[model samples]
Target chain A: MTAMSSAGHSRERHALLLMLSVLAVLAILHIQQGARPIPATVMLDAVLSPDRDAFDHFVILSLRLPRASACIVGGAAFGAAGFLLQVAMRNRLAEPHVLGLNAGASLAVVLVTTYQPVVLPDILMPFAASLGAAGLFGLVLALSALGSGRFDPVRMVFFGIALSALASALVSAILILNEDTLEQLRFWLVGDAAGGGAAAVWSILPAVALGLVAGCLLMPQLATFSLGESISVALGASVHRTRIAALVVTALLCGSAVSLVGPIGFVGLMAPALWPRLHQRPSLGAFLLVAGSGAAILLAADILALGLLAPTELPTGALTGLAGAPVFIWLVARRLT
Target chain B: MTSRSADPPTRSRLTAEALSVGHGGQAVVQDIELDIFEGCMTALLGPNGSGKSTLLAGFARLLPALGGSVRLDGSDLATFPTRHVARVLGLLPQQPPVPEGLSVFDLVARGRFPHQGFFSQWSRQDEAAVGEALALAALADLADRPVETLSGGQRQRAWIAMVLAQETPLLLLDEPTTFLDAAHQVAILDLLRDLVRRHRRTVVCVLHDLNMALQYADRLVFLKEGRIRHVLTHPSQCDGRIIEEVFEMPVVSLKHPQSGLPVFLPCASRQPEARP
Candidate 1:
């Protein structure tokens, strides 16, 4: 048993290292291959030397680096939040987008852009988006709890879908009310990494860090919780307390991610949906894998968006939605059959 | 009560006094007083809607009391921290939904969470408890297997192993033998008996099979209409009158040929419409 566990541990470690290395290589390729395609050697030199050309430094430091970091952070946050929600609710369909969190954030952004555009600064967008997400999350919890005597997974999902529809309606209404803000809202709503500065990134850093730490703390209790509330309580876990903490962490992560990158859908839902099938122990390791895989998928999507339509510059969020629709269909089909 | 203070060298006992169980202001069981002795297997026997499960949940502190109190080692159960209470008492509900793709080992390892601090996530004691629980349940060979892939009996054993890994002095099980076949049921009952006898763990289980309950249980708590009809400490103490009154049927009480314990056989009423 000891030998077998040791071997399994080493294999898992090797797989994790390999995945990290792949992510690193993909990030490098993303930096080196852009519209004004710089050679790998030149990109490396520009990265190493301080006196490189202004354009090279601008592409490497100002544009590609921030975009790549945003993709990583956004994907990680969504993936972690999705995994936490699924475990807490014990439902596979519990993702921020599916649960109205993304829609809520987008609606708040739309409201700010349409009505309070002159007062709201760029750095405040993510915070506003987070509040929207948290608000919607709390609403879903309250509505579900009202309907069911206990926290039923099916009721929670239905409530989230209803909230999502309402948020979408509000967003569309705001868009129609202010035609001038439509152009700005259109780009932001579709989920783009086009114009985030160092300030925007720094603004969301604390939330992301706090969410990640809380997620790690709640992972073990989540395992117990998945066994049902009775068993969790029997195992000495305070079911209500653990579930509330999980929801709070999820809201923070999803809210921060939505604020950073406008309502990137499917990464959170799909990463967790696909992770258990790939791993042996679908507990903490599965959560980490889903987060990492979400990051990789988003980074790859951004690369495709950048490279496929070079000068046109499509929004990464639209590409993700397009790519994710068919996968969602397939998942629903698999679940049915 | 006298046996509790006399058994200083044995394990602690779990007892309830005038316990009334309810949910959301609706009382189910009322004014119950019972004692589960150390190193004994006690079975709560009742028909459906008789409040057996409600009583068990109250004993485990999963359900709040509507009236009296439950005492653990002569202390109020409500005064103990949830974690501290869990370290001494463990309860497993019937047919708990297992998480998808979780390994048996990982599921069992969660039993050690109450004993662990934030920084001390995994320890040698946790590993040992998990290993011993797996061995106890005969699931050592399938420790790494996903619970979803296990057979019904194996899955039930895996859940029992998780409860065992808690290392509690008292264990409560609500209908642990629901989905098992006869052979598996006997195996699980024998296992529980051995745990009580060898490890000095007090076990309180709710069972539907009166004959099995009579054979294995050191004490039989018979409940009817949310009230304690009678508590028989030994098989010889179980009278046919008590069984008939509680179960609403005539029964024949005879000594078992193998164990010499009293066994019950319910007789069919001689009504013309009741017959096929």
Candidate 2:
């Protein structure tokens, strides 16, 4: 037992090291690959200690650093959010985008942007998104309880899908009627970190940090939850408490991510999918690895979005959707069937 | 049929008095009065829709009783916190869904949830309990195997091992032997019997196979139309008339060739005489 556990420990350690290395490489590439590329030496020097006068230092500090931070922060939040949602709902397909959380957040942002009597600053946007996500989640919860008093996993997912459709339609209608708002939101709506990069990161940090801490604290309880409700209840766990806590964490994390990056689709889905085996045997370390995977995938995708188009930046949301659609299909085919 | 006192001894570990449990708004099992004794394997036997599972659910506190009360050791079960109740009793629902890629050991380790707190997640006591449960379920060799990959009987045993790790003296199982072949059924039954005899655990299991229940169970509670029809201490006391009346089918009692215990066998319905 000692030998086997030690071996397992080392394997997890190695995997963590590899993931960190990948994230590091991606972060560096993210900082270097924008419009007018900075050389590697300049990038390193800028990161180590910026010279106030150097144009390269200014570009790295002002432009790329915040963009990169957005990707890592948003990705990690989505990853942890997705993992917690799946555990709470006990469904593999339970992710922010699929469960209407992203659309809900988007709808909130659109509503505030279009109809707020005064033009609020970009920093206050995530709060609206967080409120929307939580509100929609309550609706989903109430609808899931329509038939059985118990929260059925499949029923909740179906309701989320329905709510997602409704929210999307409303958003499209609002955008079409208001063309001025449409042009203003044209780029931001598709999930780009270029415009309010630094401000977005700072705005969403506290909520995301709170959500992640809550997720970590609820890890042991969530592990029991994966065993299904009856068994979880039988084992003396208050399933209701765990479920509510998990959903709240998911809402905070996902709402903050959506507000930051304009609902970058599929990071949540891909995060859990990346650590399929780890989810089966949930541990705090495994959960962190999943969150890390989400961070890495998003950072890499954002870099690809920037690098692939050079001066013409593709929306990170579009790139993630392109990558994540197939995974969503695969999970449905494999898990649902 | 032999008639006796409806109220058993006061020392019963788990008891249900006037318990009416159901789904939605309607009661499926109504006015159930039964006592689960200590250190005895009690099998609930009945036909389909006889409320066997419902009664078990009531006892396990998985479903709320519509009218009456379920008691654990003389106290109303609803008064105690769920976690405290869990430490005293363990329940295995019928075919609980197994998480993908869950190992037998991890599955058993979950049974230790009631014992551990937030900071004291995985202790030496937890490990020892899991190891002991794996051994007790005869699943030590297959501990590392994912439950999805195990054979039906082995998977069932692994689930049992999970409940065993709870270290509860009373166990409530809803159809533990379902989906198993005859040999595996006997093996599972023997395991339950050993639990009662060797570990002194009180077990209440819902069984469909009358012969198997007759062969293994120390006590049998027969149900019909949401009511306890009869309760017998020994298979020798059970007769075909009660089975025929409750199930509404003809049956014959045959003595086993080796053990000479009476086994109830369903017989063909008697045909009506010709009009002539």
Candidate 3:
């Protein structure tokens, strides 16, 4: 028995090591590949010494640093949020984007840029987005509880889809009303870190930190809840309370990510969907694995977006959708078979 | 929240008075008054849609009582906080979905949630409870295996282990043998009996198999159409008339030669013309 337990422990340790190494490799690759990119050696030296040459400094500190940091922070938030949503709802398809949170945040941002431009300098756009996302989440929760006292997964997904379409329509209306600001909003709406400075990254740090802490605390409860509401209750968990807490955390994280990266699609859906294949449970280790995987995917996509067609600069959100769609399709097909 | 420390832990009792339970303001079970004492394994037997589960839910305080009250330790259930109630009572619903990729050990460890606080997440007591539960359920061998990958019987045992880990005085189970094979069903019933005998835990389980209930339970509460038809104390008291009345099926009760318990057999249908 001791030997068997030791073997299982070793396997878990090996998996953890592998995930950490992969994350490290992705981080290094992210720093080495970009427009006017520096070599790996120069990037490392610039990271170690901030007072390097202006060109190396620009490549390392100004350009690559913020973008990579955004990927790490934004991706971790999206992945953790996605996992929480799926576990809380007990539905594999229930990602923050699919549940209309990203759409809600995007629409709110578009509205701010169109009609409330004067308020932009005074208040951050992400805060507005968070409010919008929370509102939409509340609507979904109410709709889900319409017929059944318990939260119904199918009804919630359907309501989210409908709300997403409505949000999209509102965004389109705003863009049409303010045609002059359409070009400026268009670039931000497409999900890219092209001009996001350290300020934008810092804006979401508190939300991300709080969300991660809450998500970790709720992990054990969510694991029990995934068994079903009755079992959760029997095991001394308050299913409704746990789900609400999870939803609030998900909204905060996804809203913050969308605020920073402009509604990056598929990261939320893809991360949790992929993590279980590598790790056993959605424990803290699995959470970290999914977060790291999400960061790696986004960072890699950013690199590909920049390097694929040099000087053309395809938006990272477009690349994620383009890349995520086929991969998602493949996953579905695999499941079907 | 009343202080449970002031009261004696042993001899705890649960009773429901005119309890009506339902969802969305629609009552499914009405006027249920029953007493469940400590150290007794009570089986709630009824057909599907007979509100056996609803009654058990009411007793466990999972469903809100529409008109009456469930009293634990002679106090109204509502008087206790959720955590206090949880520490005293544990329940296992029917065929609950297992979280994918959750190991059996972690799944059972969740039973300690009521006993834990934010700072005292994983304590020695919790570990010991989990270990004892796994051993009691005969799942120590599969502790590291994901619950999703286990067989139906093993999964059911693992779930029971989770409830056992709660260390509650009262354990309520809804159809604990639903998906098991015949042998597995008997094994689970035996295990439940052992738990009641060895641990002195008060158990109320919803059962479909009348014979198993008769053999395993110290008390039998039969329900029909949400009303308590009869409560029998001994297997010999559960004869053909009670079974026929509650289940709406004609059956013959005979003594089991091996265990000397009451065993039931469904005879041929009685025609209207042969009513004599």
DockQ: which candidate is best?
1
Residue by residue across A212-318, what tens digits does model 1's lDDT show? 88888777677676677787777778788988888878878887888787888888876666543432243455566777777777888888888888877888888
Worst 10-residue stretch by lDDT in candidate 3 chain A? Answer: A275-284
lDDT of 2 at B77: 95
TM-score of chain A of 1: 0.88
Q: Model 3 RMSD to the real structure?
A: 4.8
Alpha-carbon runs more than 4 Å astray in model 2: A2-11, A114-125, A140-162, A172-184, A335-337, B1-10, B257-260, B268-276
Give the share of true interchain contacts found in each model.
0.68, 0.75, 0.46
Number of the top candidate by lDDT?
2
Q: What part of the reference interface contacts, as a 0 to 1 fraction, does candidate 1 reproduce?
A: 0.68
Give the lDDT of residue A254 in candidate 1: 86
- All candidates: CA RMSD (Å): 3.3, 3.9, 4.8
lDDT per residue as tens, model 3, A1-337: 3443345447666666886787688778877776565778787777887775578777688878888898888888888887788777776667687678989888877777678756674226656787778788788778888866756766877898899889988888888888886877777688886647677898788878888898888876676666677766766677779888988888888888888887887887787666454322445666676777777778878888888898788888998889777765676566569
lDDT of 1 by residue, B140-245 (tens): 9999898889998888889889899899988999999887898989989988988977787889999998888877887889999999988876756887888888
Clashing pairs in 2: none
Q: Which ten residues in a row have the lowest lDDT in candidate 1 chain A?
A: A275-284
Clashing pairs in 3: none
> lDDT of candidate 2?
0.84
User: How close to the true structure is residue B214 of candidate 1, measured as C-alpha lDDT?
Assistant: 79
